[model samples]
Target: MELRNDPQSHYALNACIDKYYGSKGLPCLPYGGVQIRTSVIDGQIHEDVYEKVYFVARKYFIKYSIPIDTKNCFAMLSFAIGPNYVPMTWLVTEENESKFRVDNTTEAVVHNLAMLDEYLAGRLI
Candidate 1:
């Protein structure tokens, strides 16, 4: 969760995340997830609208220790929003990309990576 989050909200969020990490052997953060970007116009990229996330900045790796249930299901919980923590059930994607999910009810398989780019922008599952 490479956070350069609001200073006012950073403390509690960090603490909650830390507690989860402590239980996970402190492997640090989960840095990879398929993100779906939707801010573009009709899925078309605008040169002027594109922005670099970090040219060179501090990276806050956010991670958690979640175990799958008896049904081989588990959700990734996030406390980055302070009190409004969010969770997304484990899903199977084409690449499996560690912790990536493609949410589409119309199709069972995920083909478009573009539709998954927003997760990097802090979109809830």
Candidate 2:
């Protein structure tokens, strides 16, 4: 589906970024304007490949002491502004009410994170 970029969505998107990223940056836009760069969780994939994303996310859950159960959450990409602020993968609860950034460093992750906001209101799963 096409992503929404109306005034209301932009405002809400900015607010969400501020809340999650804090003072790091605000008013950041997706790198390529309304496109998802990855299909790991956003589309169909092989079981092994799909698990790779969770494997990475789970590592962060343990390192960061995130309390959410593994089965109850899904992974999504994060919004990043610049070089110093690399994009991250996020573990989001099924309810979509809570999210925690996962530690990931790779060009593919960066592209996915940058374009994720353009899909499913910042979600892809």
Q: TM-score for all predictions?
A: 0.23, 0.22
User: In lDDT terms, how accurate is model 2?
Assistant: 0.31
* Whole-model lDDT per candidate: 0.30, 0.31
In the range 5-123, model 1's lDDT, one tens digit per residue, is 23432333334433444554443332343222223468875322110111111333322322212133222333233433233233234344444432211121111222222354545
Q: 1-125, model 2: which lDDT tens digit per residue?
A: 11132445434433443343344343333222322222345676422211111112212211111112234333344332332322233333454323333322232233343344333355543
Q: Over 4 Å off in model 2, which ranges?
A: 1-7, 24-29, 36-75, 78-125
Q: Please identify model 1 stretches exceeding 4 Å from their true place.
A: 1-5, 30-125
